[model samples]
Target: MHDVVIAGGGPVGLFLAGELALSGCSVLILERDRDLTSPLKALPFGMRGLNAGSAETFHRRGLLEAMLEASGADRKEVGADPDASEAPAPRDVSHFAGMGLDAGGIDASALPFRLPGPAMAGFMTSLEAVSTVLTRWAASLGVEIVRGAPVTAVTQDAGGVTATAGGQEHRGRWLVGCDGGRSAVRELVGFDFVGTDPLFTGYVAKVTFADPRQLPLGFNLTPTGMYLRTSFEGHLGMNDFDGGTFDRSQPLTREHLQAVLRRISGTDVTLTDVELASSFTDRAMQATRYRKGRVLLAGDAAHIHSPLGGQGLNLGIGDAVNLGWKLAATVHGTAPEGLLDTYTDERHPIGAAVLDWSRAQVATMKPGPNAPALRKLVLDLLSTPGGVTHVYRQTSGLFHRYDLGGEQPLIGLSAPDFRFQEGARLGELLRQGRGVLLDFGRDRALQTAAEGWAGRIHYAAGPVRNDLGFTALLIRPDGIVAWADDHADTEAFQRAATRWLGHPRTWAPQVGSGRVE
Candidate 1:
């Protein structure tokens, strides 16, 4: 039996597959679509933004640079030079609702905990570029991809999961549904998807306009609806708050799109041709639980929200990263009891927060008397340091912290990318997909204690210029700080190690003293 059978071959599934295979787990990806290329995943329609956490995840796996390079985005554009004397050049800033925040107003200095490094907090790329890079990477790691085979049914018991696709049956120890919002696996597994419904039907299309100047240059919020025009020729987006009226199953036509555009833009904008068109809604829903029995769900299968802030992709990718390692460990027979449950506990709240964030944007963008005041207040607030910082932190995914419960302040947070005295950075060490026991004191006893878990954890001793308030840190494979202490104690270190790595078969010396029995 395969170690994992993933439904859907999108970026999230491919990423999870690569992670599992990196740790020597067999993965098989079942994709519905045979052709990976599509116009909608190309220019303006395919554009997506990667938040801080997603970018860092890619960097930890040594794939960020390659993905960016393939997308034609300059490395310098994503991050600033640490040694630069002058202010770093500004890139495109993120928006909440339809109002954009000023890039210059953001004060990065306020975020002292954020490390200075080459990794970016946010960057824009197309879906095609992301899928191309991840597909290649996953394939290189020995992940098997079977396209044109959609998962029609799924059955699971304590033993394993069985998925039926294209008249064939596949069995695996675990199953993860990474399919899009409308997941067949989730439906077959009978997961409870509970949340609010859609408020509007949104449209994104690539059209050949007879007269483009009739529309506004950038995003235009009208009394009736909203519309956006990008730098790409004839790429347009329109939002019609018709209480979710338009039929999504029906194919979109040029006539229908032109009518919608003219009505929303309040212009005589004529469309000559529609090269590509698609529809989405504000319907937000999340599975009550991420896992049931031997079956699990990730990406859109677990939770889905409006694409207002472009957070859907980022959130789904986060779920894959968080679940991949724990699930792999479980299959490898090394996970502590209840370790798999932590995925739902940690990521559920994050998903709920994103849903609320999108809902808030929709509320503020509604065309009504109250919306004007709300928008004005939000814009005014975004202009200030406090306002800008809050919005930046929320949208950038930098504020994410797990509830790993520990005395140290950095516990449950992403480990700071500290530069070691020996010239290796924390991100560099994480590339191998192993937990790290970072020690700045060069405690020989600590190294000895970690030897029992030898291949599973790496022991490194190096001094950092800025320790970020901690002398040592125990980082997980996913780059989260499971344990941290201001001052090293033998007992404390032992407890932390046992909590994450499981109790060593044979105990070693104390953290700072002589060997023990």
Candidate 2:
């Protein structure tokens, strides 16, 4: 039997498969669509923002560089020296409910926990590019991906899971549903998907306009609805607040899109051709539990929300990364008691928060007098320093912290990308997909404590340029801090290691003079 049978070969499934395979677990991905390439996943419609968490996850896996290189995103133009005769480079900007905030207003210094690095807080990318990169990487790691195989049913007991897909049966020690929001595995598993419905139907399309000048350029917020026209040829988006009257089940037509454009933009814009069109709603939902017996849910199958702020893709990727290592450990028979359960405990709240974030955006964008006033208030707040920083931190996924029940603030937060004196970067250390016990002081006791978990945990001793108020940190496979302290506490360190990496399988004595065992 395979270690994991994942439903859906999208980015999330492929990412999780790569993670599992990196840890030497067998993974099989069953995708419903035979053709992976679709216009919906291309530019304009397919554009997705990669937040800090998602970007860092890729960096740790050594995939971010490849993706950036492939997309020609690595060759960024260097800013001209202001002291010289050249103009400074343009600053990067982020948005809140379509309200833009420049890099100047955001005070990165206020974020004391963020590590100094060249890694971006956020960047624009397309779903097609991300999926393409992940598919290749997963395959390289020996993951088997089967397309045109839709999962119809799933049966699970304490021993394993059996999935029926494309008139064939597949068995695995565990099953994960990474399918889209309309997840068949979720339905068959009887998961309690609970949440609010949509307030409007959103449309994204690429079309040729009969009279392009009739529509205004950029975003237009009207009394009835909102619309956006991009610089790209015939790329437009509209939000029709008709209590989601548009039928998403049917294929989108040119006539329907023209109607939506006219109503939302309040313009007599005629569409000559609709090259591509897709509709989405702000309907938010989340599975009550991420796991049921030997079956699990990740990505869109676990939670779904409006694409506002482009948080959906990042949230799904975070779920995959967080669940990957824990699930692999469970399947490898190296997990501690309750290790797998922590996946839901840590990720469920994040999903709920994203849903609420989406709801807040939709509420402000609703067509009403009150919504306009609220939008004005929000815009005013975003113009301020505190508001800009807070929103940036939240939307960029930099402020996400799991409640690991530790007094230390660093605990349960993403580890800063520390630059050590030995020229090793923290992100580089994580490329091996193993937990790390980073000791800045190079304490012998800490090294000795980590000796038993050598293979599962990598112990490193180095002096970092910036300590970020922590002398030591125990970073999990996903780069989350399971424990941190200003000073080394051997007993506490051992306890945290046991809790996260599990009790040492074999104890080994420290070798002479060498720091690590």
Candidate 3:
């Protein structure tokens, strides 16, 4: 039996597999699709934006450089000067309902606990690039992936979980559904999926347009609906406000697509041929809970919303990162009490926020008499520096606080990429997937106390180029700031460490123990 059985071998599943393998847990991935290559996963249609949060996660995992190369993005564009004493200003902002925010308006000084690092900005990439990079990483870690195996049944008991895929039974100590929005594991596990329904039927297609000039490029909001045409030739998108009544399973024939485009654009734009097409709805929904006994869900299987803000992929990546380490710890029996449950506690609110964000975009773009007025009001507010900064903080995926109940403001947030004078960085330390305790004060007590958790929590002490006014900090394996203190309080540090990494103690490996010491 594998330590974990994952449904869906896409980015989330691959990433979680790698994380588990990094912790010496065996993982098996059952993918629904036999082939990874699909037109929708290539350029143009497959294009996705990796927010700074996602970038930082990859950096901590030592995969950022490869991801950038796979996406054909220049390192200079995505990274900042690593040697700089201070963090760089934010340089990227996401659009709100086609209304762009000026990166210049983002107040860098306002964001707390930020430090200069390689991944400072979000960049464009495709699903294929992300998958390629993650697949490579997961395979290098010895994760076994079985494609063309769609999960059909899942049964869990006191011991573990057994999943039926492709007419075969695979047993694992735990199971996670990383499958896409239409997830079989979630359904079979009896997770309650609840949320608002969709408002419109959206379409994306690659077509041969006879009269491309008839429809204007970029986002065009008409009295009836909205249509978008990007620089990619023949790439078309439309959002038809038909109460989301269109049956998505129906064939997207050229005639139907042309009619919808013409109606939304209010122009007789001709689609000579539709080479490819897919339909989606703003049907926002989320599983009530992330885990059900031995079975769990992450990525789109846990929650789903419209792709309006380009947050779906990034959100899933966050889920994988947040859950990966905790699950691994649980499987290893080294996790603190309730550690596995915190996955839902810390992430559910974030997922809820993303869903509401998507719904807000759809509301602003919905065809109605009040839409123009609402859009105008929103645009006016977004024009201000404060408004722009708020949007950046919300959308950049960097500023979320997980409510870890620490007094310091930085607690419950991602740790700053603190760099030691020796040129080591927090990001590099996290590549091993273990808790990190940085003793900036180099106090003997703190160092001695951290030794109890030796192998489980890596401890380092030294002067950093910038300590950000902290003498010490405890960072979780996922890079979250579990605790930070301006003074080297050994008692506080121990408490924080014990809360997250379990009580510090040395373990001697016994024969056939199947445990890491």
Candidate 4:
């Protein structure tokens, strides 16, 4: 049996598979679709923006460059100078309802513990680009992917989980559902899904516009609804506040799309041909708990919201990285007690916050006498330096602080990429999928203490360009700072390490002998 059998082979599933495989766990991905390539996942329709947090995640995995290349984004546009001594100002910011925020208005002084790194800015990438890069990476790490195998059922017991997919049963020590919003594994596993219903039905289509000039480029908010026309020819999006009454399962006929667009845009825009189209709703929902016995859920399977603010994909990536290593350690018999449970504990709140964020956007865009006033007020607030900075913190994905019960500000935050005097970086050290113990003081006692968890944690001692007032730091495999110290405290380090990486092993038992010397 494989250590993990994941349902869905999308970006989140593939990324989780790679993380597990990197930690030496056997992983298998069951994908519902026979083909990975789809017109909907390419170019204009699939264009997605990767926030700084997601970019940093990719950088730690050493996949950032490939992702940029796949997305055809200039490296300089998405990253900061490598040799810079200080962090740079924010150059990118997310929008609210249709109102854009100025990156210049973001107060850089408010964001703490930042340093010059390659992934400081967010960039645009397509879903196909992200999927391609992750799929190749997962395959290289020996993850078995079985396409056209949709998960039909799941059963779990004390020993393992058995998932029925494509009429075949696959066994694994654990199971995770990385499937999209309408997830089969979640339903089969009896996870209680709950949330607010959608307020509107949204559409994205690639069509031939007979009267292209009818709708102008950029976001257009009308008294009734909102519609967007991009620079890409015939690429269109519309949000119709028809109480979300549109049947999404039915075919997206050109007539229906034309009617929606005309009504929302208040212009008789003609669609001669529709090359591709898809529909989604702001029907935000989330599983009450991410896990049930041996079965677990991540990404849209666990929680789903509207595509507003473009948080769905990035949120799933966060879930994958956060859960991957903890689940792997649990399967490998090296995880401390309660390690696996932290996945939901830490992620559930974040998921809830994203849902609310989506709901807020919908509220601001809903067709009503109050919507315009609300939108104007929000825009005014978002225009200020403090207001824009708040928005930046909320959406940037870089400022999230997991509740790790720490007094220090840096704890539970993504580690800053500290450059060593030797030109090495904290991000590079994390590429091996192991915890990093950085000792700026080079304390012999701390180094000796870290040896107890040698294979699980890598110890590196050096003088960095900037230490940020810390002499040492313990970063988890996922690149989260588990502990930070102003000085090298060996006992504190050991305790913190044990809390995350488990108790130290001073010796190993002889193979076949089953006994320690």
Q: Encode model 4's per-residue lDDT on 1-517: one tens digit a residue.
A: 9999999999899999988988888899999999999888898999888999999999888898889889888989777887789999999899988888899999999999999988998899999999999888887777899999999888889999999999999999999999989999998988999999888989998999998988888988898899998888888999988767784767899999998888888877789998888888899999999999999999999999989899999999999999999998898788899999999999999999999999999999998888888899999998999999999999999989999987999999999999899998898888878899999989999999999997788899989999999999999999999999999989989889999988896422111110111
What lDDT tens digits, residue by residue, belong to model 3 across residues 229-338?
A: 99999999888998788847678999999999988887777888989999989999999999999999999999999888799999999999899889988888888999
Tens digit of lDDT per residue, candidate 2, span 1-517?
8999999999899889888887778899999999999888888788887876677788778777666654556423211231222222224545666667765777766775755454545567888989988888887777898899999989987779999998999999999999989999999999999999888888888999999998877777788888888888899888888777684866799988888888888878899999988888888999999998888999999998888788888998999989998998888778899999999999999999889988988888888868788889998988787888777777767679999888888788888787787677788788667888999999998999889897788888988877877888899999999999999998898889888878788522221110011
Off by over 4 Å in 1: 82-93, 505-517
- Could you arrange the candidates by lDDT from highest to lowest? 4, 3, 2, 1
Error of 4 at 258 (Å): 1.4
Best by lDDT: 4
TM-score of each: 0.94, 0.93, 0.97, 0.97
Better of 2 and 4 by lDDT: 4
Model 1 shows how many backbone clashes?
0
Model 3 alpha-carbon drift over 4 Å, by segment: 507-517
TM-score (C-alpha, index-matched) for candidate 3: 0.97
**Model 4 stretches astray by more than 4 angstroms:** 506-517
lDDT of 1 at 221: 85
lDDT of 4: 0.90
Q: Which scores better on TM-score, 1 or 2? A: 1
Q: What does the lDDT read for residue 461 in candidate 4? A: 98
Q: How would you encode candidate 1's per-residue C-alpha lDDT over 316-338 as one tens digit per residue?
A: 88898889888987887877888
